[model samples]
Target: MLFEDKYEIIRKIGSGSTSDVFLVRDRKLKKRWAAKIIGIYSGGGTDCRVKQDAAREIQILTQLDTPGAVKIIDVFEDSRRICILTDYIHGISLLAYIHKYGPVFEQTAAKWLLQLCGTLDYLHNMMPPVIFCDLKPENIMLKDDGKLTLIDFGAAYQQHSDVSPGIWKGTIGYAAPELCHGTAVPDIRADIYGLGVLGYFLISGLEPKQVEKLKDYSGHRIVSRKLDRILSGCLSENPGKRYKNCEHMAVRLRQFLRKADF
Candidate 1:
């Protein structure tokens, strides 16, 4: 569909429970952008609630200005839809990369961890900090330049934003147990749990769901405890057992890397 009488839809690139993403091009600028279209209209007239949710995501995007995030270039709204225009990222999902290239090496994982932690730290430190409740490998994109970007923010919610219940929470194995059950309010620990799951999968080349049975490390023997210690805590069923936040987790990572000298 044509939008704003200028942005032409190239094709549908992706979709989510709440919206569909299309690759669109600006006729004047000859630049491409990903437009996430969220339906805000119903049979009667307008779905105020849906519009509110769309606005929430747009608001969160505007506050984000980090390399780890896809930059928001513009926004468009009509009678029936809200379009969030963001930079078109050309990359592979972390999960897809791991499948094709095997688990990332220790050195690579360490570098990636710092980048992710820095990104999350920025998100968590926002004015009304945003929590990326869903952070599985599928949500992270690895660019050709070796930089990682958090591509999906549909589940990101501002801290104490008075959101209604029944919203999308998180994944099963990757999400913190509390999020799985919708028992505890989302916090930094939830993303930490996801980091643990992703880290374990990358290092072991095994599924996080089988983290118990595959009690083995496929990488180096040195990172066995140093990295696993923190990751294990992140996988804890209880949030208290996980690192307080990204800053706390990054400190451990840096300390371990310095000692391991990898």
Candidate 2:
């Protein structure tokens, strides 16, 4: 219930299947931060796998130190729970933003995608290469300063070999087909697929289910030819057919932005 003597819990901000996140404040510095409290299990209460996942999330967050990604400030564990403190971002989730304001403009979507692509590139190029298995509107935060932040590392993994087999660990609609089917091993391309889905959702206000039914974005009048090509490639059913990597996609997106009159 109680965190470190210095941090005071304000309120619960969010909760997931395995953890609950809270808005906490440091008494010493008088600064706010988000703390994720993950329940620890010993013998039978919760699944052992869930505990491993929480530990893994803590490990990965501790390793990552990029501005685009949420920074982990402190980590502690007690007999019953594991607590992780990170910078408190002030703003709304991309999902809430879209629901409130409707689909974003093509130009605005392009800019957001560029920022996300750069972040993904950094993750995929890390020492062991972090694969952000989960990428969706809810996982992205639009800060008040007009920048984006990627949060929720519960599904992230460090790719050790060509294909690491594991259970599917992403949202249904936003996850890549390979990940959903559990037939193929997911790699960096999986994240590319997610980025494509995200772009479509932002520009068209269409969920992944609707997006998947359409053959292409040609039907969407707002989608420019260059943007359409990029989205199509990124959402390819086959991972191999998607963009080579996030960096490759970022380069293309930047080029598109340069030529786009909007």
lDDT of each: 0.81, 0.84
lDDT measured at residue 14 in model 1 versus the true structure, 0 to 100: 83
List model 1 lDDT by residue over 1-262, tens digit each.
Answer: 4476879899998887668999999989989998999988889999887788788788888888898999888988889888899988898988888899987766578778878999999998988889998888878889988899998787888878885444555777887787767676777888888888888777767776777744544543534666778777777788898888888888888887787674
Worst 10 residues of 2 by lDDT: 212-221
Candidate 1, overall lDDT?
A: 0.81
* Cα lDDT over the full model 2: 0.84
> Considering only N, C-alpha and C atoms within 3 Å, which residue pairs clash in candidate 2?
none
- How many clashes does each candidate structure show, in the order listed? 0, 0
RMSD of 2: 2.6
Candidate 2 Cα deviation (angstroms), residue 8: 1.7
TM-score of each: 0.89, 0.91
